[model samples]
Target: MKKIIVLCVAALSLPIAIAQEKITLTQAECRQMALAHSEDLQKADNAVMQAELDKDIAFAAYLPKLDATATGTYMFPDMDMMGAKLQMRGMYLAGISLTQPIYAGGQIRAGNRLSEIGKDCALENQRKARMQVIADADNAYWTYIAVLWKVRMLESYKAQMDTLFRQTESGVSAGMATENDLLRITAKKSEIHYQLQKAENGANLCRLALCNVLGCDLDTSIEPTDTVIKVSLPAELDTDISMRPELRLLHKQVEAAEQQVKMSRAEVLPTIGLSAGYMYFGNIKMKSEVGGQSFTQKIEDGNALVSVLVNIPLFHWGEGTQKIKKARLDLQNAQLDLQKNTR
Candidate 1:
């Protein structure tokens, strides 16, 4: 019977030990995992990737474009000379062409510049998301630690009150203290219990928030191996506004807008294009009749050509003027935003 009791006790202890062997996460480890797994960060990174793709697309416009084309045709009831009947003709042709843009009225340049600005903005937005995640994690970690400390303090207070209640009971029994004293201590103990409950709830909530930021299961247990360190802020501000990502992004926007204005003005100027192509024509048909003898022949010919195209915009109603005005206003607004963010 004693052996059976010992075996049961050992079985219970085995499960408890297994439960305690689960993995625990340190604060730094949690932060690193959050940086890699957080949904918000991933979205920000995707935005940056999209911006880069846009930049690539915009830059591609400056390069030459190549294309190939083919055509087939069939004709019935072919026309004849001197009111005589002729045979029908069928033909097939194929060609390749290339066009290079030497100039585009600054449109390509402005587009590339805008893409660069967009990329910068996307990067800054990513930085902001990262900072927000770090701040949130910090707040959650500190709050959790604070609540845990509060729980410990409440437990300590409860233990002292328990001892006091026992002493008061003993005193009352010996006719040295009144029952009211014991009742007061009991009331205090009840209040501490309520506080402990509240503290536990707060700690649980903090853990949930931390888990959410870390992109982990809500029920997963987290044990912060690192202790929270408190630091006092400096009395005087030493950080400069120019170093802030917000300010830098705004400045880049202003510069991009200025470039846009310049590009818009360039639209009024002439554009030049250098185009060259090699084309092949196959299966050409020609009708011929000599001494009442008719025949068909297949031929192929290749040709290379180079040309230059120049475009001068004399007038476009008020579209160009409107664009220039819009660009100027955008530059002004970007400047104002930069100023505001700096402040």
Candidate 2:
């Protein structure tokens, strides 16, 4: 019975002990947690992955493509022609073809370049997302620390007020202080109490905010183990904006737009391709009679062929030129946007 009671008591106390435990986190740790918790950052990473796949798909245009086909046909009845029966009992064909583009009027190259630019833009966007997350985390961490320090300062001041009130009470008992003075001290102490409570409430709210930023449970207690440090200004400040991710992303956009113009221009140009194929057919029979003689001929054969294909755009009512003009306009717009954002 005693052992069972001890076990029950220990079990009851475990939760209380766990609830009282505080998690100590540093500024760097908080930033790391916030980065891991950021959903936007994760989506940015996914975009980068998708961009890589797009790049690969664009590059595949430069490689050869292989395809296969099979077909079968069966005739239920024979046809009579020229005083004879013609029979095609069953026909089967199998073929495989390989095609490689020799030239595509620079469209394939431009598409690949556009894909590369998209990949670069995705990377830059991811970098920007990381920077934003870190900045938010740092801001939340510093604000929480400031509120905690304010609460500590208010508590210390309240202690000093308490000591003063006690001294004033002692003086009043010895007739050195009046009842009015005692009442004033009492009022001041009450004010200190109210201020302290308010400060504590503010600290709790700040802690909750910090927890939200860190993506942790609201009920979990956190202790920031870092202190605000003094800072000194550098002798000289460098003003350089070229390395910012936002600018890089815009730069990629401009490049992509330029590639789009190239691809549009390619629409009016000629394309060249090479193809090789081999086909096999079997089980085809033709029956006929000539000069009072009947005979059956079975046709089973295979053939291979290689050929070069060329296609040129002839006339489309000025559509190709209009598309190229539109693409050029889009490129110009992209350039203008980049220039505006850079300034």
Candidate 3:
């Protein structure tokens, strides 16, 4: 009696455990969780940050630069003269220098423009990432729902067959129905069982795919709520490709190339700069007398200088000319690509 009671308890616990393992999710919750945990989205966010840093680096050229220097030197005379032995003397110097860019052949301005364009490109990339995530979520949600429906339908069919099987078994024993009827119902039940298994397997695969996207463990249960909102499609799309990010990025590239050409051409122009510095030197003693050493007074000096420079590119083995041609070609290619994509 004890053994029979233990077996019954174990059998009852197994069904309860299985029943407790079911997962339920709503659609909106699934999408939110996926977006929050997606590795691709995280990487896209990092890329945006990197691009912003690059923009900052590019704009740094517009700011003035300050540098400080300190040097100590010990000098030794090459030879003795006038019966005085050559000796080493120590010298210390410190200075601060400032450089402001008065002009730079338009290179700094071009760099700033390119940085802005790059930021726009990064934003477009982020948009693309978001679109991909939403699309993937939609597909996964629909597939899961479809599988659940299929499983329910199959189980309903299985229940009907179970009743028929019992009826046919009783009929055969009473000689009212042939064994063939019972065999047919059993065969149909087996087929339905196989289909149910396949459907269940497919549902599990869909669940795993969703888990991968959400960066969750395979065993984690996700229940999605339905979000099948309907929206009308646009009557027409614009023929011009400029609205697309790929085209926009290409246009920016062309503009950047044109700027580069202009910068290179401006290289032949003159550049002007203004610089200023102040220096202070400590006193140096010449000799030690009875009362005190003869010392030179400390010297403070300030200087301001203005300079203009011109660099004439007389010849560089055709490097500059080649670069200009390349820039023009790139602009043409970008335009063609935009046209192609639009079509």
**Model 1, stretches more than 4 Å misplaced?**
1-23, 79-90, 228-237, 266-268, 295-299
lDDT of 3 by residue, 1-343 (tens): 9999999999999867764554566766767877888778888888889888988998887787787777665665523444333333554567776777778778788777877777777877777777788789878888877887898899999999999999899999999999988888999999999999999999889988887776677776667667354678789966665567666767666676677767665665556555555443332223222345443333334444444444456777987677778777877887777667666
Model 1 per-residue lDDT tens digits across residues 242-326? 7677677788888888888988887877888887777776655456766899755455688888889999988799788888999
- Candidate 2, run of 10 with poorest lDDT: 81-90
**CA lDDT scores, all candidates in order:** 0.81, 0.90, 0.73
Better of 1 and 3 by TM-score: 1
Which residue pairs collide in model 1, if any?
Answer: none
Stretches of candidate 3 exceeding 4 Å from the true structure: 1-24, 78-88, 227-247, 263-272, 279-304
TM-score of each: 0.84, 0.87, 0.77
TM-score of decoy 3: 0.77
Candidate 1 residue 200 Cα shift, in angstroms, is 0.5
Ranking by lDDT: 2, 1, 3
Error of 3 at 13 (Å): 13
